[model samples]
Every structure is written in C-alpha cells, then in structure tokens.
Target: MTLVEAQIDRIVGPTHHFGGLGVGNIASQQHQGQTSNPRAAALQGLDKMRTVASLGVPQVILPPQIRPPIDLLHDLGFTGSLTEILPQVANDAPELLSAVMSSSAMWTANAATVTASVDSAHGTPTMTVANLSSSLHRAIEPQQTLCDLQRLFASFATIIAPLPGGAAMRDEGAANHMRLGSDLESPGIHIFVYGDQAPLPHRFWPRQTLAACQAVARQHGLPPENTFFLKQHPETIDAGAFHNDVVAASHHNLFLHHASAYYRADDTLAQIQRRFDDLHADGLRRIEIPESELSRTDAISTYLFNSQIVSSSTDQRPTLLCPMQVAENSCAASIVQRWIDEGLFADAKFLELRQSMSGGGGPACLRLRVPMKTRELSDLKTSCQWSASLDRALRQVIQEDYPESLDRDDLTNWQIAEKCLAAARRIQDLLAPTR
Candidate 1:
C-alpha cells in the first residue's frame, strides 16, 4: 500500500500558562507558577511545524483547545453567566479555576490513539480520542478534541467515540502508544504500554491502564496477533517518567528506548522480536540505550527520546528533531555526537522550544502522527493541512488575537477570560475555509 504519514501538531493557545497541571510530569511541577510567554510559545510551535514541512512531511495544525474551560465551572455548579461564574469559582475554588483553564491540550500527542487501515482488523484508518478522564486538568479535553478532529477528518476517516470518562478507563492517548513498521503505511506491531493496575504505593501517578489499551484496540478492530500489551515498569513512573514517551520512542521500524523503559528490558525485546518475526524475519530494528551511557534521570530531564526522527525522501538517514536542552547538557551532547558518529541518525536539529520544554513536552509530545494511504489522504479535509500561507496567517492571528502573556492572577479576571474566548473564536474563524 502506498501510504503517507502526516504529523498533526496542536498550536499553543493564547492562555498558555505554567499551571503545572499534569501529575508526575517533573518539568510541569518544577516550573509551576513561572511567567509564560504565549506569543513565543505558539510561534515556536509553528516554527517546528515549518521545519517538518520543509523536510517534505505533510503537516496539519490541531488548533488549541478552548481555554478558561467553562465546561468544568458549569459542572461544578457555578451557574449564572460566564461573567458571574468566573468570580464565584475564583473565590470559592481558585485551584479548580486554574486547573480547568490550563493549556495542556497543546500536547496533542495525548489527544488520541490512532490505528491505520494497515494495522486495523476492519481495514479502515481510525482515531479514538482519549478519555483523558483521570486528572481533572486533562479530563475536560476529549469532548472538544473529538469535535475538532471530527471536523478535520470528517469525510475520510472513522473516529471512535471516546471511551467513557472515569479512572477505570484512564487513557493517555498516543503518548503511551507506539507503532513499528518498516514503512509507516504498512502493517506493523502496535505496542500499548499501561501502568500496573493491581495495586501500588508508587510515588508518581500511573496513567494509561491496560484495560483502556485493550478497549481502544478493540474499538479500532486491531488484529489480536499484531497487537501487544505490556505492563509499564512502576520504577520508571516513580522516577518521574510519567508517560512511556518520556523514556521510549519509535519511528518507522526503529524502536529506541532507555534500558529501564520497560519492566524487563531483555524479555520485552525478545517478545516484541518474536511477534515481528512471526510476521517476517528480521522485521524489527531495535536500540536500547543503556543507563551507563545515559541515565534515566538525564533521559527524562533532557527528553532525548522525545525527538522526532524525520526520514528524508532521498536516501539520507532520518534527522532527529530534538529540544536544544539535549545538546546543551554536556553528557547528553557527547552521547548524541557518539550516536551520529555511529551512524544511528543523520543529524540532530535542536529546537529552542523552552516554553514547551518547561511544560514537559518536546517535538514528539507536540504531535500525533497518522499514517494514511493515497485515497485516505485525499479524502481528508484538505483545507486543514499545513501550508506556508497558513503559517503566516496563524502568526497574524497571534498578532491580532492571542495574549502576549498569561499569569496566575489573570485566571480570575473576567475581562481577560472574555478576551481569551474572543481570541479562540478568531482562531476558529481563521481555520474556517474561505466561503
């Protein structure tokens, strides 16, 4: 099958702030209450998309989820009008106000779990927006996420209604999912890593349950043989690597992860290899970076694996799109240099996404890659795809609409909240096709 994989990244919203919302995300907590630059954050994200597009990759923007999320306020019984509700919630439950207003939706990697036609038993490309129902901050996302994607891929793809919201079916979206295909458009193994659900007094929060993974796979109709579910190492979670993506990442047929990423590194590799071999011998290209070479703390701190490996249409090796912090760290820089010398990657493109990095996200965290074939790609709402002009237009939106900065005190301001809502509507207007 001739297929194309497009990367969809969420544009940062004007209300972006250092709410430090996500549980167990070290950077989010460490950078809590810090002043945030909304303009720089969104522009940097756009710059990343532009870089990927220049490399011949099709790109799309998943516009930021509406901020000052009033949905939660209504649910919390602060009902009157948005103007009245804002002050009431701010006084009665300030923390809740902050949680709902978070810009965490910019990390669209956790937006959904996608299954390509090549990998699905039903033989149709599918998207199932995660019911990020565990943490209150993220729980409000699935509904709006579904609405935007439904509009974006309305004609071509099938989208599964989100799994019901609750702790039992806590789904962390694509961040906890990995696909390994020699060609992304072809069939490959689907690895779903969920945390230990039985019982544990672990220090950090454990997201992505096994039941949720199984439910998503079933919903997408993925063939049982090609799908693999593994228990995440509780130790890694305790160490502040909240999501699997923090320690592991894959591209094409290459799966590169830290040795401590899984519960039993060697055994997990063997099982994965066996599954791949069952399909075809030597189908897997694996690399496990040992702790001695790069420690787990450093891996999480620097986000080495969160880099996106973009393959060239030419014979050149894939370039690793990384956060500049990786190269700035002395030891990680040497290790990356060693990898380049060893022919592991073409080269590293370090991005100054300090805004995103401050919130525990990198290149990989910002996108959800969906592999589609010629027909499926064509069936997509073409207007939603990224273009040079769209980039300029979006920047114009920021200039005219988005806030320059967002701080803790701004959450309670009804006028600021109204402005945020107006700015979001303007973005929606920009996204709409010229009629």
Candidate 2:
C-alpha cells in the first residue's frame, strides 16, 4: 500500500529551434531565429535526467512528439506528398513553418495539470492537457500530447481534454498549478494560481483564468475545501515570471515562494493553511524569500524558484535540484549559498540544462510532478522509466543523428526531415520494449 511520486521530464526534440513565439517567455523572444544546437540540446536533457535520477528520486521520460506537424499542414490546405509540402510551405510561409517546427512542447511543465490518485474522485490520477491555443505555434500541441499520454498512462489514470479554444478557455497547465502534501502518500492540497486577464497597465497576458483552474479542479472531482485559488502578482508577470512556478514552488508540505509571488502574500499563506487545515493533512511549511533578499528579476532570470526540491536521502531535508546558471549568477549564487548555510535544504544539486534555459524554462519547467501508488506506477513500461541503458541509448541517438544546429530556414529541408524522422524512429525503437 506504499505510495510514490514521479517526476516526468520530456526530452527536447530534434526540432529545438527558437521561433520566439512564446509571448511571455523572455528568453524565447530574446534568442529568436537564432540557430540552436539540437544535438547538444537533447544530450543536455539526457544528462539532466541522469543527474536527477542519481539523486534518489524516481524519474520518467516523456518522448518528444513529431514537429512541423505534417497533418496540420495538410489541414491548412497544403495538398501534396509529405516531401513536397514541406518545401512548399517552407518557401511560401517560413513563419508558419517556423511555428510548426517549434519544439517548445518539450517543456512539459505546460503539458498539463495533474491531480494525484489520492485527490481524485475515482481513485485514479487525472491529467488535463493544456490547449495552449493562445498562440498559433502552441495551439497544435494538445491533441498529440493527449494521444501520447493516453498511450503511456492508459492503465492507471483518467485523462481530461483541454479547454475549448477561446480567450476565456486558455489553459497553460501545471505552470499555474502547485500541489502540496505532507508526504507523497497522503491526500494533498491543490493550489491554482492565476493572473488578471483584462488589458492591464501593459499587454502582459494572463495564460490561465480563474475559471479555467476551477473547471479543472471540478473535472478531477477534487472537493471544494481541498482546492484553493489565488491571484498571481501582476507585477511579477510583467517582470517576465509568466507562470506561478516562476516565483513559487511547492512539494510535500513545503511551499517555497518569493514575497512577491502572490498578492497579499501572508494572507495567501493563511488561506492555504486554512484550506490544508480543512483537509486535516499535515501542517504547511511556508518559506518566503523576501524580495529584499533577492529581486524578482534575479529570481526570474536565474530561475531560482524554478529549482526542484526533493527530499534528500541523506538528511531527509529538501534539496534543490537547481540549474547550473544559478551558481553562475552572483546574486542568485549568494542567496542559494546562504540558504544552504542556514539549513533550508541539506544541500543544492546544480544541473546543466542551458538549452531549456535559453528558452526561459529551467529545472522545474522541464517536468510534471504526480503522486501515485506503487501498483499504478507499474502501469508504465521501462521505455518511460529512467535507467542507465535508456539514458545511454537516447544520448547515442542524439550524438550520432540529431542535427548540431538549426535555424528557421532549415524547416524546409526535406533531408533534415528524413533525418529528424529517423532520429525519432530511433527513440521509438528504444521504447519498443514496453512492459
């Protein structure tokens, strides 16, 4: 009857290019149209998976989906064989081609919001894929993401479809959702953070609406008292921390966030405590890092809050799996050091994930966290499971096949398409031994 938690990280695909399409992600726009090293990128992701697994946590791999969505091209009225249409679209509409080629879905943090089996009505975990319909580039991801998740988790979880595409229904997924529990085995609290939608002082977009979060909670059949909703500080969004995770992170009973992470910060914590009190779950651990300690800009830029916190096997205290960039940034480095010195966590584990970082996603942005029982965990095969063999195989494919660098114009190259498909097929072969 033991329960466990799984953190699923998606491998960045061969089509990892900067379309600069993500409206709220500053790095995507900052590095737009720049040639990306896909080979190194995928390997870097593998390295991260290997590193996190070494840290005494269960890690799972979510495969990357085929990009330049060929089916979508056909739907767009481009009639031709696969080979012919790629060039036609590339020549006529490279911008559209760029959108199709985007691999931003690799950041599965936006993939969906998950409610664990312990929290759901049917005693099955429920996943809701984000529509991501807010932008032309991301709108196409949900359908494929749903298909893949169904194939991967069919035995043990209920999957919910994305909200209907509209300004009102825009759902950005787990980035807006944070789960808190005393341990992975217990019933946990679901905290949904949202931003203001109306045209504010600036044109900053609020990806998840309060309505969307509420609908998701009900879909999962979470009790009203167990679900809490809070408004994200608009000023943080304007400063480029678009999603709640940008400024806050929660695991087990610990809720670590910036002082500016939410409006009426102390009151939000009180409300969270009240909600947790209703559940009769373990008490909450609230860690608020004052802005005076670290500026919101530094927090967002260094992705300090986006760092993953796992229970250390050595001391059983929370340990941060932070991006290596945090150590490189003087402001962030000092704070992280001080945190460790003060025993906030037993220690910090820094990982190199620059490719994901280049696009404004960090360690926390690469995965979805779900708590489930041991039997339900067996529902997935070794392909999705993390291991040294799978790790080496994926890295080999990336080194031998994935392109070293790619830019916007390369989307039209049929040869690259064939190679990309081949690389994907190799990844497919690794997952071939499912069971």
Candidate 3:
C-alpha cells in the first residue's frame, strides 16, 4: 500500500498560440498576436516530461482537448463545416475565433484539484474538475477535462463535476491549492488560497473564489481541522499574480513564497506553522522572498516562485525544477542559490520552457500532481502513463503532425484546422488503452 506522487503533464496542442486570452496574465497579453511554434512547443513539453521522469519520479501525459470547439462554434450560429465557419468567424470576429481556438488546456494545473487517496475519508483519490467560469475560453474546459480524467482515473478515484452556479463559484483548480507534509504519502495540511473579485478600475480579475475552495473540501471529505483557507493578497492579484502559485509554492515541509503572497503574510505563516506542528515533529521550512529583494513585478515576469519542488530518488532533499527565466534574472538566480545554501533544496535544475513561459505558464503550471497507491497506478487502464516507447511515439507525432509556425490568423485556414485535428488524433490514438 505504498503511495507515490505522480505528475500528469498536458501535451502542448497543435493550437498552442499567443491568443492573449488570459485576462490577468501579463505574459499572455504581452505576446498577443505573435507567431507561435506549435511543433516546438509540443516538443518542449515532451522534453520536460522526459526530464521529470529521469529524476526517478512517475510522469504521465494528458492529451490536449480538440481546438476550435466546433460544437460551440455551431452553437454560436456559425454555419456549414469547419472550413466555412473558421474563415467566416475569423473574418467577422477575430477575437472570438482566437478564444475558440485556444490551447490553454495545456496548463493542466487548472484542470482539477485533487485530494490524494491517503488524505480522503473514502481512502481513494478525489478529483474536482475546475469550472474556469471566469473567462469564455477556459469556461469551456471543465466537461472535457472531466471526460479525460474519468478515462484515466475513474477506476480508482471519485471524479466530482465542476462546482455548480457558474461564475460565482469560480475555481482555478490545483494552481490555487497546495498540500504540505513531510512527504506525499503522509496525510498533509491542505491550503486553499482564494481571491476576491477585483473592484472596478483594475482590468484584471481574480479567478479562484473562497466559496469554490470550501465546496471542493467538503466534496472530497477532507477533515475540517486539517484544511485551511487563506486569502490571496489583492494587490498581488492586481499586479498580475492571478493564481497563488505565481507567488507561492509548497512541497512537503518546504513552503516557498513571496512575503506578500497572502493577505496577512505573518499571520498566514503562523497559522500554517501551527498546523504543521500538530501533524509532524519537524518544523515547516519557510523561505519568504521579500519585495525589496525582488519586486512583485519581477516575481511575475521571472516566474521565480512558479518553480516545481519535486522529490527525487537520487537525493535526500527535493529538487527545484525552475524555468530558465529564473536563471536569467540575477536576483532570482541568487535567491535560488540561497535556497540551496540553506539546504532548502538539494539542488536546482533550470528547464527551457520559454514557449509555455511566453504563454503565461512555467514549470509548475504545466502539470497536475496526483498521489496514488503504486499498485493502483499499475492497474490503471489508460496508456497515459509514461514509458520510453510511448514518449518516443509522442515525439514522433509532434514532429511529424504539428505545424512549424502559426500566426493567429492562420487558424482560419482549413488546412491548419485539419492539421490540428490530425495531430490530436495521433496523440489520442497513442494514449488509447490496449485491448
């Protein structure tokens, strides 16, 4: 009955582009309308998964949802086939076209909030697909994410539908959720960070609400004593730290965050430490980066805190998987070195995830962490689990089927849409379970 943490990463889709659809994400908006390299994006994602697997951790791949959402387009009153509708909509309403063709699903961190089998009262994993009701493009994600999760984990986990009541119950999934303990196998303290809707004057808005986190906790049957809800610092949200992960990351005993990550920074840390003390003998490690050292603007731009801290078999301490942006920034690089010097991490590995970084995601945003019994994972029916052969096959699909370059305008062409479909099909086929 050994439990292990597995990372489920989304394969960057053929429709990967700078749609600038994320309202609160600065990078997304800054790179809007720029040409994107789908082939390179997909390949970079695969390389990331491969690197994670090489660290002696289990890595799983989640295929991207179909782009353009043809059904939705039809419902939008676009007539005829994809060829006709795509060009017609692109010509008449380019923004709407970009929204429908978004590949933001590649950020699986927003797909769901998972309660590990060890922590749930049912003694099985529980996953709640995010509603993503804050934006039009992301709002269309829950049902498809649910379908994919059911196919992958329904055998051994309870899959909860997205919270009802739409926008009022906005949920951004695991990006706003964190589990902290001595290790993933241990029952840990669940920290749900949420934000208030922005008042007028600010263009960006916060996505995760307090109500959504409470609902997920109740649905997963998490112990009330062990679960805590914290508020995101409004100023940080306004500063483009849309999700808590942008300013904070927690792994096991390490709670790495910016000083202004929460509403009442000192009180929040005290509350977290009190809970950690109740659960374990060792103290919780807190690495708070002050604003003087690195401003919130730099934090968002460099994505320093968005790094993933994952356990490794090769070392006693967990390794920090950071985006190369952190390395390029002198201040951020020094901060990471300090973490190593303080023994917070055994070491740090900087990955080149520029494509995802440009799309407003970094190493942490690209994967969803799921803790499950090792035996259960082996018995799973889906072929999403990583294997050397499957990895090779997926690389082949990306190289052969994905476009070398694509502009937002290119999405209107019939050939581009067909190629997207073809690539998705190849990936789906590869992930289909063997009879």
In model 2, which residue pairs have backbone atoms overlapping below 3 Å?
A: 181-252
**Lowest summed lDDT over 10 consecutive residues: which window, candidate 2?**
195-204
Task: Score candidate 1 by TM-score against the native.
Answer: 0.95
Candidates by TM-score, descending order: 3, 1, 2
lDDT of 2 by residue, 47-76 (tens): 877777887678888777787677899989
Best by TM-score: 3
Whole-model lDDT, model 3: 0.87
| TM-scores of all predicted structures | 0.95, 0.95, 0.96
lDDT of 3 at 313: 64
Give the Å error, residue 368, model 2. Answer: 1.1
Candidate 3 RMSD to the real structure: 1.6
The lDDT ranking, best first, is: 3, 1, 2
**lDDT (tens digit, per residue) of candidate 3 on 11-120:** 89898889899968989989998999999998888888988898888888888889878899888888999888987897787779888888899999999999888888
